[model samples]
Target: MLFHFMSPLALSNSYFLAFRPREEKSQPRLSTPRFSSQRTLFLTENNQKKLPFFQARHHWMEDYKYLFKVVLVGNAGVGKTCLVRKFTQGIFPPGQSATIGVDFMIKTVKVGNDKIKLQIWDTAGQERFRSITQSYYRSAHAIVLVYDVSCQPSFDCLPEWLGEIESYANRRVLKILVGNKVDKGDEREVPERIGRDFSDVNHFDYFLETSALDATNVDQLFEQVATRLTNDMKITDERVHQYRADATNSSSNQGGPIKLIDRAQTQLNSCCSRQ
Candidate 1:
């Protein structure tokens, strides 16, 4: 699962690690730690305890706080492959062939001391693969819709892609629009303003212009995805924690159901006041 691919800028390697999807049947539970004379534990930013640095390698594989599935979709030859390659492998695949059905990669990134594992799916853009790609949308935590800046047809077909996304993706999935091939300077057909405008009109969570060839804004694109998803998940975790606390307190007062509504209303009011 390791390959050496050469780009004009440098020689780099891309790794396609063999990944097994984490089981969803049971959630991982953190238990109170028991101190041992032979072992030491360190606290993460979120106060999760872990093995000390020297013995953490084995634990690191499962150390992530969250796992996000990020799928890239757009028309064929739009450089979706290149963008993923550049960010994960630091290589601009020269004359890269169109992705067949799907290319998958795994990368672990840190968002403010929390480890986030990104499961990246680089999907084919050909019409023939449309059915297959749509299946991935529903389970994705985020979707990146890419277009080539030099290709007008690719830009024009965005609506078709958006339609497919709307039909298949989760309603709350993070949506990102990326305009690739910014290296095609003079040949650019899609202006930055036009891309931003489309993103706004279509309610994209974020928009970015990137040049996989030169690595412009390439890393930033995926970093933003991780940061946004992590933040959103943290907020959700907080609400769940609040609900549990309220339920526990309610049982003591025999006001279980009513307290839940009151807690939710208080949270809503607090959010509105902040806004």
Candidate 2:
């Protein structure tokens, strides 16, 4: 008998969501709702091919309604990676390592009738990687600032993080504040009320406390991101439509002679039809 075991981190990275909107159904649906299973072969340290079990929805090469970039930023060891792993893979990475410069993963979710492909960028929280991380802020549609509830220093650094966000991120980017590790009741140094107040005072669009280890609010957090972005995009598209309509009306009105001739032709056609 042969036995093989995989670590949590390896398992988390092995599978990723590749959701495609169903062609036949009016509503978006995944082929494997529970867990889309996919297999990948990789060369092991011993130069032998190994297959790891992972769950993700397999989709065709091209199909998506919208693509969004979501970036995560906070101090080191703030459970940013763990939060992402928990949300993306439904696993708590006990031995998660700090991100180097940056890392990314793709997860497709259905927001209303729109199939949104979220490109989640997990940046290194270390000061040395500040330059690298700051560059990603401008392109992100949503920015999630994460802090550990049990760590006072992390909470205290929110202002500094906000400063960086203001300096680097888009002026209209959706900002969210997340206090992670709320499961640590006795270890918690920052109260929920304080976190909420800070978020309100700092003008965050929304605030929530989460525990990646226990999978509390992890799914809700990402869902909120997708929902908010989808709504915002819809509003923007409506505004653009209104602007175009106004522009077309203005252009038509400016065609004074052409409009009069067209109106005369319209009246002549109506007269002929009446006859």
Candidate 3:
């Protein structure tokens, strides 16, 4: 029950409490109350007071650098480092040492009302460091599987990267397929259809052909990822309104969804009726 009490008190906005027994054999005692907000509040139920443990993460934003973790994975020499260098440090410097394990960088991108600070992990694309680099995949919210547009072997190996991620990465991770180094048609080996097929079968969020050497669609790609991630974090008004409506509807039908009773009064009534 929602009560506008004159005094300040803690409340569960639109939730109910459930009891779960502790499995420990030590104490001879009792069950603890667990808060569940799966149900809606009812206006008819009276004498309801707030029980602790209804916690919700509030929406707030600071610098976009701390909100999300994104990972980059693909074959060796697929321009993963070049793409990152172009975006974060500016200019894809040549003759640099290949990634030893995983390199990290930060970029803040705006998405609707929030700014998401993306912590991008560019994993080593070589076969040797797979063990070392694979651990980073577990924490990523989004994954970009890169393939060189000019290399069929790199494109063909895309499935292996995808398979690894499915086996061990974040279960809810969003994925995107990227074809890098599009500027070099002289060396181009993979066709556009290859990228499309990978995107379709794996349910990629988006696909783009980019030239990290020239900096193409690099910003747009990350922006889209940042936007999608921010959306995933939010509890929107639409969902809130729909949940309220569903609960209200459920409460009004036939027998009230769950018959709630005040424990003290229920015991008293049982005794009197028996007598």
Predictions in order: lDDT: 0.71, 0.69, 0.62
Q: How would you encode candidate 3's per-residue C-alpha lDDT over 20-115 as one tens digit per residue?
A: 123424212222311122222111221143322232111112223224667789988888888887887678778766676776666656677555
lDDT by residue (158-242, candidate 2, tens digit) is: 9999999999876667899999999999999999999999999988988999999999999899999888877765554444445
Better of 1 and 2 by TM-score: 1
Best by TM-score: 1
lDDT of 1 by residue, 124-218 (tens): 89998787788778667789999999999999999999999999876667899999999999999989999999999999999999999999999
TM-score of each: 0.74, 0.72, 0.64
Steric clash pairs (candidate 3): 64-117, 65-117
Using TM-score as the yardstick, the better of models 1 and 3 is: 1
Error of 2 at 120 (Å): 0.6
Q: Number of clashing pairs, model 2?
A: 1
Off by over 4 Å in 3: 1-61, 235-275
